[model samples]
Target: MLNMRTKAVWGLLALALSAGSVQAAEPEVTDARLSLLPGDSPGAGYFNITNTSDEPLTLVGAESAAFHMTEMHVSTTENDMARMESVEKVDVAPGESFAFAPKGYHLMFMHRAEPLEQGDEVDVLLHFENQPELPVTFTVVAPGSM
Candidate 1:
């Protein structure tokens, strides 16, 4: 009986340790918004994501039913000219945060499937490397609001 008790204790301890080692908090997203342009122009998405987990996270891309194609982009200036370039991935270290804002890292939502108006809510699924996709709700706003 004593031997059985010792084995059970050891098993419980191992289980607890494993659980503690692998435990991580979910990533937090805030201020998610999508700026829509008139006509067939591509929309822009902005948000702030905080990595609350124990490991690093990489943002790969995004998808939304409102748009046919969503891509990650970064805006920069060179020789007094503004330039926007596509980015494949963005890494955020543990306890760090990344912002998708105007004039910086942002999402380019192209080819709208349907007409969207101001105050409408858009559902965007953010893809990450080695992590499950994160669903975020973005409120549509006018381009001038950004």
Candidate 2:
């Protein structure tokens, strides 16, 4: 027979386990790639971010050892001229996926430490507002490969 205190502790343990399971189902990144441009030019990165939890997820920033700075950018066309702008954060709804592709939302890697070659792999750490920092590997590909 379990005492009242023992029973309460067991109940709390069960609740903690349930909460852990819920946290495990969060946002994730997949199909990540970085474009390799010629010379010392800046490159773009593309990926798909999926939200699996019940609430929305916001991607705040990103960092990489290969570049001096990483920023989220979106391309827009005004009067037939395409331009890119930096964004502070990207919001993703539950059960939805955000695409970072060409002519759309993407990551701008600025001031690279060294020029990235084809088939090179780079590690990028993605920061979120409500979740832990996600470590992602981006494969370097030729320009315009998408």
Candidate 3:
């Protein structure tokens, strides 16, 4: 049988190894961006993210030079009123995607530079809780459009 001290040492080693494996299991997101929404002072983004590893990923915030502030917001109709709410995190399943589109799931931009117009491109950076600083280019679209 192992001594008490030896058992404790083995337990510590196992814990350290487990932690390392978890840290190495994060997935990577590619080609992600915020889509331009129709209206004023706010917009959203759409992107494709692939979770390559075992660990899950969450998108918590975003940043852009064109806007004063960026947040991950969700749209839901409650009591005949269409309202938007902030999301704490967006979880991406392993080998899956989390898309952000208008009128459903999207990024809300505070105090935009100007009214959004089609064919305009801007730089936006997405922040995930697990993987932060994923920057990409964004394009504006016309109203009553996708």
Candidate 4:
């Protein structure tokens, strides 16, 4: 009986340790939307990513079936001129949030793979370093809305 109790206690301790090592929560994405341009022009995507995990994560890029190419970019005004440059990655610390808004860090979706219109929904997969790809749905909106 003593040996059996000891084994049970050890088993419970292992189980507790495993649970503690598990990630508490996955990252949360909110306010996902896309600014769809008219005709065959490229569009832009915006959203907010909240890092709920215990460690920092890097957002590398994004992919979507609606677009053939997707890249991370940042828009800035330099010397009275607007400039848009490609960004390699963005880091979000634990318990922090990152925004992909207008004139800020955003996803540049180019080369449409399919037809899209306003009010349509598209699936986008956000790639991260050292973490699983996060799936987000973006609603198409007018370019002027944004």
Best by lDDT: 1
- lDDT, candidates in the order shown: 0.94, 0.91, 0.70, 0.93
Better of 2 and 4 by lDDT: 4
Task: Candidate 3: list runs displaced more than 4 Å.
Answer: 1-40, 114-116
TM-score of 2: 0.88
lDDT of 1 by residue, 27-131 (tens): 899999999988989999999999999799999999999899999999998999999999999999999999999999999999999999999999999999989
Best-to-worst lDDT order: 1, 4, 2, 3
lDDT of 3 by residue, 39-83 (tens): 654666665666776767777777888888888788888899999
The CA lDDT at 53 in model 1 is 90
What TM-score would every model get versus the actual structure? 0.89, 0.88, 0.68, 0.90
Candidate 4: residue 27 lDDT (0-100): 88
Candidate 2 CA-lDDT value: 0.91
Q: Model 2 RMSD to the real structure?
A: 2.3
Candidate 4 lDDT over residue span 69-142, tens digit each: 99999999999999999999999999999999999999999999899999999999999988889899999999
How much is the lDDT of residue 3 in candidate 2? 95
Clash number by candidate, in order: 0, 0, 4, 0
Clashing pairs in 2: none
Q: Give per-residue CA lDDT, model 2, range 23-65, as digits (tens).
A: 5465778999999788878889999999988888999999999
